[model samples]
Target: MQFKNIISGAAVLLASAPAVMALGSATVVNNCGYPIYFASVGQSQHANMQPLQGSYSEGYSQQGVGISIKLAPNNTVGGPVSQFEFTWANGKIAYDLSNIDGYPFSAGGMQVVPSTQGDSSNPTCVPVDCPAGQSVCTAAYNAPDDVRTMVCDENTSLTLTMCPGGSAKRSVEVREHIRYRVHARHFTVEQ
Candidate 1:
């Protein structure tokens, strides 16, 4: 009789173990703006981006176009919204990024105002100062008035954004976007 009772107790403990584990994971939480897309500084493997097909304003000027691409649902993708490799011939760019990742254009012309609005906003450094050994701190291209800006050129600048992880339930470590500013002329003289 005692042997049968022990077996029954073991079965009851096993049955309740699952319930306890399920209760531990019962709490649900989510964040909408966690994985934000900001400017990066290099080429991305995500080379299948298509054009947004519309004019987007950076601050006051409108020069560049926009596109909406399906960010491939993968965990291996990473970049700061750098130079949009627009394959105009192929009618494709690399990725579609409005809120996700992109460079907003000014209205006047190709002369783009460097600002940290969309992909330019997320800088890796704090406003105060860069840590020891670091030459220049990474900052979003915000100061259009200042000659030195992060978003100097597309070749040097990069685009970055967040994407879903390998597993939906698994938590992913967030990384900051790093874009290198390319050489650009702020003002020009027309003859």
Candidate 2:
């Protein structure tokens, strides 16, 4: 009888334990003058399709799996779109801005800024600021082999802004070497 009681008590304690929390969080801000629609694409689930008008914001947390926040000026999915991709795992968050599909916000731009500085040894922890009208931003992955991935501490919060201010106009030479490369695959979740 005592053995059975001990087993029952252990099961109760295990069941009452707190669930494992996600290691990363992201906030999306719409700084554009018009409304934009965003969808969260993850390995298992795709959700949160909502319209964000100027100055509005939405936030979410996710486990250490690949996720992409797809944004577009219109509500439809076939039109021009951009993406912010991230995966939080192994004590770090690997992230990148992808213009591989298309860039809808040419007049405005997008940026991903980390809440805190990442590992000092990793130089790719800097912010990814893709200026307006830059179709081939060097800070983003322009091709499948583009070396634009950045990393930050897993606990570092990230803020993604659409149409951020001070997006200076700069001319960047499109890398002729990878111009013909195919677009890299992006995260997608079935509805």
- Return the TM-score for each candidate structure: 0.17, 0.67
**Each model's Cα RMSD:** 21.7, 15.0
Residue 59 CA displacement from its true place in model 1, Å? 23
lDDT of 1 by residue, 1-191 (tens): 99999999999998888542110000001112222222222233344433322221121111243322222223222432323211111211222112123222111011112222344433421111112222222222232342222222221212322211111221233477665554585544433
Computed on alpha carbons, the lDDT of every model, listed in order, comes to 0.26, 0.73
Model 2 vs. true fold: TM = 0.67
On the 0 to 100 scale, the lDDT of residue 185 in model 2 is 72
Q: Which regions of candidate 2 fall more than 4 Å away from where they truly are?
A: 1-22, 44-48, 53-62, 166-191
